[model samples]
Target: MTSTPAFPPLKTYLTIIACALLLGGCSSGDEPASEPPRVALVEPLQPAEPQPEALRLSGVVQSVTTTQLSFEVAGRIERILIDEGTRIRRGQPLAELDRVDYQLQLSEAEARLRQLQADLARKRTLLAEGILAPAAIEALEANTVAARVARDSARRDLERSTLSAPFDGVVARRLVEPNMVVAVGTPVFEMQDNRHIEVSVDLPEIAALSIPLGPELKAEGQLVIADVSLPLRYKEHSTQPREGARTYRLVLQGEPPEDYNLLPGMAMRVSVQRPPRPQASQDQFRLPLSALQADSDGGHYIWQAADGRARRLAVELQEVEGDQALIRGDGLQAQLPIIVAGGSKLHEEQPIKVQERN
Candidate 1:
C-alpha cells in the first residue's frame, strides 16, 4: 500500500527504470577491441647480396700497330690484287708496277757483265804471258766488278716495282687505283691487325699507382651491345698521364667478339673490377649519389633497412663514380643488397615495398 502511494503511475516507474538501465549500460565495462594482429607494416629486411666489383672505364678503341704500306719506287700501278678491308698475309703481293724498263736495264747489265768477263780473261792471259801489262788486267777486273754492281741495282729496281704485304693484317685504306701513278714513298695501303686490340684509357693517379702489374689485374671488359665480358691485360701505364691532373694511362690487350667487331678510333665502355683499394680497411658500399642526405646536425646518412623497416644510418663517403657513391660504415653488410637505383624518397622508420626491377 505504501509503494503504490509513492509512485505517480506504473508508466512513470517503467520510464525511470528504463533510464537507470540505460545509464548502467553506458557505464559498464566495454569488451577490449582485438589488435590488428600486430602485423609488421614493413618491407622485408633482406641482407644485401654480394655486389660485383667492377671498374667502368671509357675511352677510345685503338689498335696496337697500324701498318701504312708505301711504294719503294715510283711507277704506275698495273695490277692491284687486294682491295680495301681485305685480309692480307705476309709477303702477299698487293700491287704491281710496269717492270719493262727495269727488265731492259737488267738485260743491258747482264750483257755488259759478259763482255767485261771476256775482257778480263783475255787481259789476264796476256799479262801471264808478258804480252800485256798488269795494269790492263787490273782495269778489266774493275770493269767486271762495275758491271756486276749495275746488274744488282737493276734487280733491286725490279723488286721495288711490286708492293707486298709485310705482315698479316686487314687492309684499311687502298689509296690508289689500278691505273693510278704513284711516286716513291707513296702510301698505297694501310693495314691493321685486330687479333689483339689495345684499349688505352686514363685513370686517376691514385688508382693508377694502386694497380699492380702482372696477371692479377686484368679487367673484365664487356661490350654493352654484345654483353660479352673479356679479360683485359694490363700492358702499360704512362709515367705522366697529364700535367697537374692526378691521372695515368693504362693499356689493355684483348680481342673483342666477332659480332662486336671493334674498329680503331671507336669509343667503347670498359668495366673494370676494382676491389677495395689495396690495404683499405673499411668495406666499400656502392650507392647512388642521390642517396646522400645531410641531417640538421650536418651529419651524413643513408637509408638503411633493418628488421623490415627503413632506418637512417650514419655513413662516410669515400669516393664517387658516375651515378655511384662509395660509402663505409657499420649497419651495412656485403650480404645485403642496398637500394641503388631508386632511393631518393624514403624516410626513417617508414614502411617500404620493394619494386622488382624488370
Candidate 2:
C-alpha cells in the first residue's frame, strides 16, 4: 500500500503555474536573428540606338609591294654598289654587269656601219656616173641599214647591263656578289616598298562575307600599330579558303607614320567599326564595372534584383571601359536594377534589399 501526497495551497499552485507560464512564453518568443542582404543598386543605362561594335582581329604587317630585281642580259656582275638594308631612291644604280664586252660589240657594230656607209656612198657615186650597176648600189645600202640596226641593238644591250632601283625602297637581300656571272632574268636583289604597308588577316568565312570588298572598306576601319592608329585602305581578299575550310585571307593597306618604323611581318591588331544591324534584339546594356562577377568556370555573371531576390544572369562581356561594361545577355531588360556593390556575396534567388545611392 502507498500513502497519497497532500495537495498544495491555491496561492502556491498559482505561483507555480505562473512560473511555468513565464518559462513557456520565453521559450516560444526566442528566435534566430535575421538581417536582409544590403546591396548597392544601379539602373542599367539603355544602350544607344544602333551602337557600333568594334571587331578586333590580329594580323601581320607587310609591305604592299615587294620586287625581285634582275638584269636583262647575261654578263658578269662587275660591281654591287649597295648591300642588304640599303635605302635606295628610284633610278639609283644597285648593281652593274661587266659592260666591256658590250662596249666592244657596240664599237664593232659602229665600225661596220661606217664602212658600209662609205662603200654605199662610193657605189652611189659610181652608179650616178654610170660606172656601177643599180643592183650593186642597192645591195650596199641594204648592208648599211643592217649594220645600223645591229649598232642600235648593241647600244640597248649595253644599257641593260646595269640594274637600277625602280622605286624608293630598302634592299632586303643581295643575291649576287661582284664578279659573279649571272644569267638573264636571274634575281640580283630583293627589295620592298615600305612607304605603304598591308595587314594580312585570315577571317572565318562568315566574317569575311560581312566585310566590304576592295576600296569600299577603307573608310570603315583603322589598324592599331603599337600605340598609333592609322587609317586603313582596303586592298584585296582571297576567294579561296586558306589553312582551313572556313578561313579566308583579307589584305588591308595603310601608310606607316614617318616617325615610326613599321617593318614587314610585325604583328598588329585590326579594328573594324560598324553599326549594328537594324533587326537586333537591342538587349545589350552598359552597366557599372562592379556589377560583373567571374565564375569559376570562366563565365561572367551579373546580379539583377527582381521580385525581392537576387538573380544571377550569365553575360557575354563585350568591352570594359573605366567603370562601365558593355555586356550582352539573355533576359536582359533596359533600366533593370543591377547590384553593383555587394554582388560578390550574393547567391541565386537570395533575399536582397536594394540600397539607393545618391
Candidate 3:
C-alpha cells in the first residue's frame, strides 16, 4: 500500500505532458521566418557601334574562260587525244575524225584540178596557133578556175577533220568516245582556262546595290577555300537579275596560289565588307533577344538593375539580326546593368540579388 501511494495516475500524467508541449509550440511561433533573396543574372548593355557590315555569302569557283569545243565537220571520231582533266596548249591537237574519206576526197579533187590545168594549157597553145576557137578556150579557163576552188575546199575539209584546242586550257569533259559518230557542231569536249579563275556569287538586290561601281573598285572581298583566304577583285555584275529570281550574279576574279588547284564548280565562301551606311545612327543597344520582355499593352521592354531593384525600361526594337535585336530606348546606356535571366518573375521595386555574368 505504501509503494502504490508514491506514483501519480496515468491519465493525469498524460494531460500535464500535453499542456507543456502546447506552451513550447506557442513560444517558437513568436519569431517570423526569413527567405533568401532571389538571384538575377545580369550583363552590361552593349552599345551598337557603327561599323562596316560584313555580308557572308556562298559562292562557286569558276574558270574565267569556259568553252564548249565542237567539231567543224561531221564524221566518226577516229581518235580522242585528250582525256578529261588533260592540260592542253593553244592549237594543240585535241581529237581527230576518220581521215580515210576526207583523204580520198582531196585526192580526187587534186586529180581533177591537174587534168583541167593540163587541158587548159593545151587549149592555150592551140589558141595561139589559131587551131582552137576563142569561146572554147574561155570555157576551158572557167573549168580550170572551178577545179581550183574545189581542190581548196577539199583541202580545208581535210584539215578540219582534226580538232585543235582554241586556247590553253584543261579538258573538263569528254562527251564522245573513239569511233563514235558525231554531227557537225556537236560538243565533243568541255574546256576551261584554269590559269584565270573567277568566283560567282548570287546576291540579293539589296546587297547588290551596296557595292561600289567603278573601275577602281579593288579588294572588296575575300574568297575562302579550305580555310585559305584569297584577295578578290570585282570583275563584273549582271545588270538583269538572275533568271526567274530577284538575285543578281556577281563575278569576282582572284589569282589562285601556286600550290592550289582552284577548279570550276568548287564550293567556297565569300565575305564582302559593305561600305558603312551613310547617316546611320549609332544610339542603339544590341541586346540578346531573350533579354526583351513584352508589356500588357504589347509594347516591348527590358529590365535594368538599379539600386538592387528591378526597373522597367521601355525600348523600341529597331532591327533583329540573328539572335540579337537592336533596340533604342530612353535611359538605356552601355554602362547600365541589364537583367538577362530570372527577370520574368521580377516586379516593380522588387529586391534582387545580382549575379554578374562572366
Which structure among the candidates has the greatest lDDT? 3
Tens-digit per-residue lDDT, 211-274, candidate 2: 6666667422333545766878787888888854678888888878887777887887777654
In order of appearance, the predictions have TM-scores of 0.60, 0.63, 0.59
Q: Name the Cα RMSD for model 3.
A: 12.9
List, in order, the clash count of every candidate structure: 12, 0, 0
lDDT of 2: 0.81
True-structure RMSD, every candidate: 9.9, 11.6, 12.9
lDDT of 3 at 146: 92
Q: Candidate 3: list runs displaced more than 4 Å.
A: 1-55, 220-225, 242-246, 273-358
Q: Which ten residues in a row have the lowest lDDT in candidate 1?
A: 37-46
- Report the backbone clash tally of model 1: 12
Candidate 3 TM-score to native: 0.59
Which stretches of model 2 miss by more than 4 angstroms? 1-49, 219-225, 279-358
| Candidate 3 whole-model C-alpha lDDT, 0 to 1 | 0.84
